[model samples]
Structures are given as C-alpha cells and as structure tokens.
Target: MTLDRSRWQPRTTTFIVLMAAANALLYHAPLFSFAADHLEVGSFSGILTLVTALVALFSSTALLLSLLALVSHRLLKPICMVLAITSSIAVYFVATYQVVLDRTMMGNVQNTNLAESLELFHPKLLVYLALLGLLPAGLLAGVRVEKSPRLRVAAMAASVLVLTVTWGWMASGTWGWIDKNAKRLGGLVMPWSYVMNTVRSAAPKLWQSDVQILLPEAAFTDDEKSVVLLVIGESARAQNFSLYGYERPTNPQLEKAGAEALQSTMASSTYTTASVRCILSHVDSSSEFSTRYEPLPSYLQRHGVDVIWRSKNTGEPPIQVQTYETARELARDCPGPERDYDEVVLTGLEERIRSSSSQKILVVLHQAGSHGPSYSTKYPIHFEVFRQVCESVELGTCSEEELYNAYDNTILYTDQILSRTIDVLKRIPAASPLLIYISDHGESLGEYGLYLHGAPWMIAPDVQKAVPFIVWMSEEFTERRNVHPAQLQAQTAHSQRDIFHTILGALSIQSEVYEEEYDIFNESFSNR
Candidate 1:
C-alpha cells in the first residue's frame, strides 16, 4: 500500500477535489441524513434528482477550492486548514443542537457574547476538532501540491459548467422539492453553509449606514407619571407556557396574577437580532430599509422620556439611552442567591422608578430566559420543579422527558421573573406602571427532530415562531390609558410589531409615526 514519498504529489486540481470530497463526506452527515429522511427515494426522478443534487454539492465545493488554489498553490493548504477547523466546529454545533448554518444563524454566532459562547463547550467538541479538524489539517499541511495553476483554473471552469448543466437538467423534476427545502439544504451543505452565509450576513454592513433615521417628533398629551417595563424574554415559547394552554403549570404565577396572554401572536423572526429589532423598531425592521430608523428606546429617549436598559442577554439593536446596565454591573448591587439569574435585572428596580423625577420612563429588561441547551443552568436549583432534567449541553443524549423537563424548568423560572416584575411595578403605584413581556423568539424542544432555535422563519416550526406575549397593566395605568386587560386578551393577530406602537399608545405619546392598527391598546381609547 505504501508509495514512494517523492512521487506521491498530486496535481493542484486533484488535491482540491480530494479535499472537497473529504469535507463533503466528513462534515455533511446532517445534509445526507436530512435528504434521506425527506427525499422520495422510491421514484426514479427522485433518485436522479438526489444524485444530481449530491453531485452539484460536491462539484460546487471542489470548484470553490479549485478557484482558491488557482489564486496560488501556497494559499490552498492554509485556506483548507482554516476551513477544516471551522467546518469541524460548525458540524459539531449543527449535529448536536440541530441548528442550521444560515445568514441569521451566522449573525447570531458573530453577536454571541463570550459568556454565552463558553456555555457551548463540551468534551465531544474536542473530539470532533481533533478527529475531523486537526487530523485533516495536519494531512493538508503535509501534502505536496504540484504547481499547476492552468489545470486548477480549467478544472474549476469545467466543474462550474458541468454543475450548471446538471442542475438545470434536474430543475424541472426537482425544483418543487428543492424550493420547498431550500433553506434546510442550503444551511446543511458543508463549508459552503457557514462560509457563504458568514459573507451574506456581513455583506450588508459594508454598505448600510450606521446613522439611524430619526422618528417623527412626539409629544405627551398629559404630564402623567407613567412607567413601562418592556421585558424582552429569551427563547420563551408560548407552547411551553400554561397561560397559552400548554397543560403545564409553568406559568402558575402569571396565571394567578391575571397576566393577559395575547392570542395568535407571532415573532417577527426566528432569531434574536431580527425579532428584537422588530420589537423595538417603530416599523417592522425585518425589512432591510426599515432597520435604518431609530429603535423604540432611542426614539422615546429623544422625546424626553427617561429610558433605562438593563440586559442579562445581548443581541438588541443599537440603544441610545441615559442608563444602560449589563448583568455583571447590576450583580454588584444585587444581593441574593438569585442574583446570578435573570432576577438580577429587577434588582432595585422599584427604588430606581421611585427616585425618578421624569414624567415618563421606559425600563427595558433583557432577560436570559430559557436559552438552551444548558437550560437547566439558566434557572436556580429551586426552580427545577420538573424532575429528571437534562443537565447535558448535548441535547440528543438526553431522553425526551429529561430534555422537556429541563426546558420547562427554564419556562417555570421565567414565570417567576415576570410575576416578580409585575410585583415590582405594582409597588410603584404612583408611577402608573405597565408591564409588557414578549419573547425575542421561541425555542424548539426536540420538535420535528430539531432542538434549540434560530431556524429560518419560513421553515421554522410553530414552536419557534409562536412566542408568548404577556401584558399586565396596573390599575392606575388601565384607568389612565383606557386600556383594559379584557380588551387586550380579546385582541388577536398580534405580533412583536405591535410592541412599538402599543407602548406609545399606553403612555399617551402622540407621534405622527404611530399607527393605530398596530397598537393593541388603541381600540380601547375613546378617541381612537
């Protein structure tokens, strides 16, 4: 089996093809597995389409590598080594968490904080790195590439032509299936998924302006001492909440406190950045152009409303406020066993409001509620109401019951935070406090063989898009704003987009940009 070492050098094109083949086989198990589960392999057209799709994937990868190699033989090894390492890490998360590599998911990866990123570390990841990453990288480093730039370029051109022809020929028979599963397929392809998506995610930043477009001038109708606590929950799905008829006691406190759980509410997106932007923007910021406008906090602050943002989690849009505190900074003043948890965001909250001299105040608390796969760690041990919780970050290793219990416990803990937040608002009766709790997005608890969140909105399950939208108005707030809890409960077809206008309506802030149709509280107002 041994060959002469001096004679073992492969041409640049052959080397690139081999590396691409290795990447496709080693890092694309999820892709093939998904295809196997979804594709109709019984029919001849299905088989031909599947085979063509596989060929397309391999050829595309090889073509990309060949083009890189054409740039310089010296660059090929380093580029592939980096790809191998990154692809290994990507596949680990992709397989273990059932998360796909899309532009949004890549954005999430880039936006993730060090603390949150550290939680994903496991021994299995090391194994994947060593076996799939370093081993191939080492082999790539040792391999000899014959300097044949012409061959690489020709090979690349031929691959592109062949792949295009094959794809176009198969399009008639496979277009429906491909279009139906495009997001999933695009997200599962090795190297290309993360590589292409990372570029796609970052490409907008190159041309988009950082300067936010100012909203219309706003004015307060009355000098009412109003306070709005907009609690942005993390990954808290409606399907897990008892208030949403989940048959679980995960929301005992919320149910007992009579929190108005709005029906038919959906998130703007499946990921935090987009969903949070939609929640905070005056208009739906899911569209590219809409993101240029100033967010709710910034807009409200500009109108002389005292805005305070306290975050235990990240991924919110640019917030320009007087007071912005993180979990670590707040933890210094907060003293309790629950200080490490999301309860820290509420520390001294009543006092902060009581001391405020402003006529209107908006306190935004971004909570780390139910963010997984370390769900059991999100809450305090006392909140582990469900037994046999899954403690492992590798969610697939745990039983369905164990995984559910862990995730439910996080929801249970979230219930406590929301109820406690309402209590904080109730004590500040002089402020005419209003509480609005909406999750940035929902999580997938092993539904359709998918775990965690961040699936593309189009393909995401109901559990990933159907978020909990709970609102609680103080007696004073209800009477002053003319927004009854019953009215809010009766409202349907609500979404995260309503949050921006609803807050304005509740505070009686008159603005040209405010839309009555999007405001949930607008119907109850006499003038409206």
Candidate 2:
C-alpha cells in the first residue's frame, strides 16, 4: 500500500527530532553503564569498547526506527510513538535493574497471574514511565509525518545502509576476542532484549503445536489401598541440604520427620517446566523437547488410578492433564491469598482424599520451593534461621552470605511444608500413603557470577544440575511395595526416568510400559 505524503508542517520535522532525541537518551546511558560495569578493560581500551557498543546500539535502533517511519509513512507517527513508549519503558527498567531479559523470563511473564504481576509494580515504575514514555509521547501527539515520500524513501534506505556498515565497523575494532563478541551482550540491552525474547517464545509454541502422542491401554492390579504423592520442588539444589552433608541443618525438619533422602539424583535440566515435563513423561531426557509425550497423569488416570496436579508456582507450558489447578485457582476455590507457600495445594485435602473412591491415588504438589530473588517471601517469618537475608530482586547487589541466608531459609520452609504434608498423609484411615519429593532443578546462588538456573547443562555447575530426591512411606506402604529400607539407603545413582516404573511397581500396576529394571524396589523384592 502506498502512503500519501502531503502535509509539510514545521511541527512534523520537529516531532521527529524530539522522538529521535528521546530514543537516544533512553537507551544510551544504560548501554554505557552496562559496558563500564560488566566488561573488563584497561583505561585506553575501555573508552574505545564503550564507544563502539554505544554506536552499534544506537545506529541499529535508528536504522530500524527509520525503516518503520519510511514504510508506514502516514501511520508512522502513531505506531512509532507507541513502540517508542513501550521500548523506553522496557529499556529503562531492564537497564536500571541490570538483569538479562531472555525467553525463559518472558515465558514466566506470559504465565504470571495478575495478582502476582501487580506485586512488581510500585511508585518507582510510574516515575520511569513518566520520564521515559510520557515526555516523548507528548511531543509526538499533534504532528503528522507525511510529505516528500520519494525523498523520505531515499533518505531511509541510505541511513539503513550507512548505519548497518558503521555498526559493523565499530563492532570489529574491539581489542580482545571477548570484547569483539561483547556486542552479543547487547541482546541484554533493553527493548530489543524483550522484543527478541518475545519472538523466540512464540516460535517454540508454533513449532511444538504439531506434537502428537499416542499411548497403549494401561491396567492396574489392585486390592491394597494406597496413595502416592509426588512433590515437585522449585529452584532447590542438593548441595545445600544437610541430607547431602552440606554442614548446614537445612533438612532438620525432614530429618526429624524421618524422611529418606535419595542422596544422588540429578535432574535432566535446570529449568522448572522443562525438568517437570521430563520427569512426568515417558520421553527420554536427551530428546525430551524433540519427542511427543503421553502425559503421565492422564495415562495414570486412564488406567483407573486417580491423579491430581496442583501448583502454587507459575509458567507451566501446556500439559495434557485435565485435573490441573494453579495456585490462583486453588486460592479462589479455597480460602487464602495467593502467596508462595506450597501448602496451598493441600487446601481441602480431606475432602479430596475422600472424593477419590479409587484404590490408587496420585496427587502431585508443584511447589514454589526455594524460588529466589526475594527468597524471604517464600517462607513465613519463623523460618528465617539464617540472619540478615538478602530480600532484593537484584541478587547481585547483595553479599554472598546474605544471599545464602535468604536461600537457606526457603529450604528450611520447604522442609516444614514437606513435614506438614506427611502429617496430612498419616491421618488417612485405610490408605497406605507414600510421598516422593524431588526438585525440578537446582539454583546458582551467585556461583561463578551466575545468579540463576537454566544455563546450558554442559557448562552449568553441578549445583545447578544436582537435585534432592526423597521418599517417605507408611509402614503399610513399605510392606506392600516390598521396599527394603536398607536397599533404598544403598541405592545412590538414579535418573528421573526411574519415577514412572517405580510408581507402577509400588502400586503393582500391570502394564507393558512398566520397566522392572527402573524400579529400585523391584530389585530388592526379586532378591527376596
């Protein structure tokens, strides 16, 4: 579509200048700050590096905005104004906060409930909007950008080529190899960071839509009354727990409650949804993303076993489980604020237990376990065993000791939640109950200057990959499944794949999909 360029008002050109100035100011300071703060450089080299980064960032931004201006022609002002405001706001906070905006964080943003998102907004955010967005947007209001269409097109093309070449040349002259590639870190440079992330997140959803999973019929051998619970922990690392001999009494509640911690178990990934999806499915860990999976809960439900998936966490990708409730849903159905406590999943537990008339029951609690930045919020006030905790979202701003203090408190709170869950199980009259606890992935806690999980597994520290897997069962459950306590203690190495067959073996579920070799309990029983 061709655009008419007939208006030649002086305000039009002035509006464009104001908009361009606003754009440069909004992003320029942060680009300089990020380079000065993060990159290592000598005085002579540092100035050159910072200059190059700023030039590349500004020229690329100008190139894109100029092209949008030329193409939209008449519509450019309104569209560009909106984009400018949005970009300014995004860049301001991300640059001010010093955090990377990536796809995983955007997935979290997409899935977060309004109540949770509201917690993020404060008076400071409004100030940012006024300074970054409103000021420029006000200048852009009455101006119409239409006139000299041919000249505008030629100028835009020339600017794009010149800016593209200039950015490339500036990027090439950095002193070291790391500095040469430092421009890639420009992805963290605000509006573009989020814009790129949004594209990446959307691409995966489109690609994965065609995944089709077909499963054979499943069956169960019944008679023994039983209940099985799988607790999916969040951001917990095995090395921190006393159960793994960390020196800190992080597992005091679990130890006192006599929960058996499986000392050596590593998660396949370091992100929540990815790890949980793998553990709860039949897909191999190596090809978890590539292969389609029959949802574990749905598969169990079809076999006449009851299954319920309840969570207090957010950002779950679509799963096949029909019996699913997030913390928001649980809070609405029951009574409570939607806080980070994992106990929300236990709301109306007695009724749920009674409602399931089936002999076999599986209830999964997806916990907001030890999730970070504001780790103190994850637990009640009493759980603060470690002193002077780091309570800010900017984890890098805090001392390492303070960060650990806040983190350990969450683990302590998790131990409390787990203990309470076991107490809930003990109340049932006829059911032999069992609880299996494992974290979806571990956390970084300021290791190697990395503050969170989701680093590619190969380069990630063991603290990010190693997870705690624990189990507790009533005496009846132990006897029924032939679980020799001695044998469980002796078993050290295990994969997440062990969960499927272990649950089946425990329930005496007769199915072709069940692998006896994966069931640790089956080995002890076979020898007996």
Candidate 3:
C-alpha cells in the first residue's frame, strides 16, 4: 500500500488544530470556576487541566483514527471533512453534556422518559448544529496545509495557554466555574467540602452572627386542635412537575389527588443545604440562615407547640444551621430508625400517630424525594414500574437510559409516599389539622446540556427554585381552622416565603417577632 503523504498531511493538520482549539475552549469555558477555585491555576490545577486537554485530544484523535481506518485514501478528502464536522458536533454535544446534562445526572432528574430526555438536547443541539454548518465548513475549505507538525505544536501551546489563563481568571473571581465544572472538579476530590462551601458561599450573609429570628404570631387558640406537618422534598424542581405544567405527567398524582398545591415559578436555589436552611428558618432565600439567628424551632418552642423535626435527607448533624438540635430532641424516636430508607421514617411516624396523641404537633419530614446519582436508592424494590431500571451506584458507569429509569422511578416512588402521607393526614381521627409539603430546593435533570442541580443562582434555571407545595386539610379542620378554600387556591400561586408565618398563624402562637409582611397567610406577604 502506497502511503499518501499528501492526504495524511491535510487530515493530521486539521485534526491537530481543530482538536486543540476545541479542547482549549471547552476546558477553559467559564463553567469550570469550581474546579479552578480549589485547584486554582497552580501546579496541580495546571497539571489537571493539561491532563484534561490531553484526554480531549486523544479522544478526538482516536475518532479521527477510526475514520481513517473505516474509509479509503481515495475518499480521504471527504472522509476527513465528514470526520471534522462530526468531531465539532461531538465536541459541542460533549461539552454541552459535561456542562449541563452531566451535572444534572449527578444531582437529580430522578425520573425521565425518551421524550423527557429529548428535551435536554435543545440548546446544545442547536448550538452544535450551527457549529457543524459553519465552523467545520470554513475549516475544511482552508485545507491543503503541509505543515502538520507546526500546527500540532501551535495547538498544544494554545491549549496550555488557555488552561493557564482560565486558572488565573477563576482564582481572581473574574469568572465563575461552579456553575459548569462543580461536579467534575468539586465532586472528584473535595466532594462534600466543595458542595458545602459553594452552598455556604452562595449566601455570604448567613455567615454573620447578627441575623434576626422572625416568628409569626400563632392564630390558633389554646383550645383549638392544631397540627402542622412540613414535608420537605429533595431536588424537586417545579418546572418538570405536572403540578407546574411541564407538559408531561411527571406529577400526575399530585394533580389528581385534590390536594391544594402551590406551584411557585420564580423560586431559585440549587442545593438542599442552602435552600432548606432558608425555608425552614425565618430567613429569606436571598439570605443565609446562620447560627446567630434563632430558627423556626426556637420560636415554635417558645410558643409552647411541640416542635419535632423528623429528618432523612439532611446529614446527621444538619449543615449550615445549629437549630436542628432543638427539634432533634423532640424527634429522637420520631423518624422510626437509623435506616437510610425513607419509608422507615414514614412508617415510624405512622406508628407515632397511632401510639400517642400530642395536642399540638409540628412534624417535619425531611424527604429523600429525589436525591441523586443512584435514584433507585431513594425508593424500594416495589416502585420499579418504569421499563428501564438502573440499580447501580457507580454514577459514571450507568447508561443514560438506566439513569433516567432509576431517577423517574424515585419520583414515582416519591409520589406513592406523598399519597400515603395524604391518606394518613386524612385519616388523622378527624382531629389533626393540616399537612403541607414543600421542597427545600429543586433539581436540574439534563437541561441545556447541563445535568445536575446546585449551579449558581445566576445560572440555575427555574427547575431548582420552582418547588412543589401540597397542602391537605380535613374538612372539619379546614372549617374550624378558618382556612377559606378560595384563599388556599390563591396562595397556591404564591412563594414559599409564606410558609414560616403561615405555620405560625395556623398554630396560633403569639410572638412579637412575627412579621405579617413575611407571613404566608398575610396578604401583604406576597408583595415581596
């Protein structure tokens, strides 16, 4: 076989330059600030960046090599052109996947279908299509270069230089990387530390000790039957939910259950740590809940209602706030057992209901509603109705279909749990008053090529903040509690900022710190 030096020359040079620039741009995109934050542009981050560039180059080159083998030299010109164009598409989609879908898979997207997954390809598909039509055509037209070695050297240098400059920008705060590169950079090494730091830093004000605790005055009389159930969901984005009209049947159960569900469209937070603290405490999502501030538990305790927090999703010791301890004392035996299984907690709470009758009960069920990587872990074996089931814990190894199957399974299972809880609330001997379900923050499932949740507020979509709020009250309890159905309907379109005060108002605890402006029941509260 005669070696076609001319053909190889053009192909190799094109591969070198195109791969280098694409690799450089992808690695150094503004999305990798988190990776740069911990590693900076020092020897370590530099080496990592170099490794990433090299891997990208090898991967792209490997594709080129395969193309060379598959096609003959006679058609080498068109083959290289096709490979170059496809490579560009691959680069964009992969970059978009890394930036968007990959990140979401790490966090949420508990359940998705083919149609749902197709929704994820939108922005990236358009971007890559545009690139394929324009950039590759221009590059192919400028072929016929004999200087392959020179191009290789230039490409390598440019990639390294891009890496160096990206590191510099990340360290200087001129760019943000957590939005794009947090899962890869942060999850790989620092894991919890990286996530915690980003969540904590997301609200710098929560670090302060001078924060104030706002408690709403309870409206219930001492003689009235009062019960408040705060069910906190995990990684439940409002947009994907049918309750929020995602055009899919994702939240069909909630929609059909006849429960009052408030779909907040504008709420935005990416992770549970930051968002839960904000919602559970009297603090606003715009601020952090620090130790300096007395959270809802303290206020509830002062008002003489039993404040019990049964948690499953939050860590052993709740991060970002110390107030978890106050409720912990009341809930030592409330959540059932130490099992990672959420159903155990639910079952245990059910047992508690059967065993004792606390006059005023504030039950906080910390949901494992859609915690990610292995969405199957969130539910038990019975909820495997979805066709594709992913039982693997190794996230990277799982197929996209398997992942979607597992995640949506979790969502489906969560729906069961929600229904059961509603059934329990309705069967509360016609005594217990109200049950409310709300998530701390929402999750991002493969949207815009972005995968997980916890992207910065500026970059995070409505999925993270738009949470589901389901309220169920017995007819007697609703009428006795003076909650007008019309009012509850109106409030369904309201924000979660009303929860703190609404709970207090329902409990009827008197507190001077309670601001009607911040209360959910307060008509003026929605204005903010």
Per-model root-mean-square deviation over C-alphas: 2.7, 5.4, 14.6
lDDT of 2 at 117: 60
| lDDT order of candidates, top first | 1, 2, 3
Tens digits of per-residue lDDT, candidate 3, 474-524, equal: 677666655665665665355656677678766766566556665554555
lDDT of each: 0.85, 0.71, 0.55
Question: How many clashes does each candidate structure show, in the order listed?
Answer: 0, 0, 26
Candidate 1 local lDDT, 394-449, one digit each (tens): 88899999999999999999899989989888888678888899998898878898
Two-way lDDT contest, 2 vs 3, winner: 2
Local accuracy of candidate 2 as per-residue lDDT tens digits, 1-528? 644343435333344444554566675565565566656656766767766655556555655556665665577677666766777667654543433556655555565566556545545667767877777676666455545454655575577568757766766657464454344364455456677787886677786755546567766677777888888899999988888888889988789878888757889776776677677766556784424656567677777777878988764445555378877677766555524367778887657877888888888888888876567788878788899998776677789899999999889888888888888888887788888988988988877666666655555678889899888978888777667678888776876777777777777687777777777677732211
How big is the positional error of residue 480 in model 1, measured in Å on the Cα after superposition?
1.6
Best by TM-score: 1
- Model 3, position 270: C-alpha lDDT score: 65
lDDT of 1: 0.85
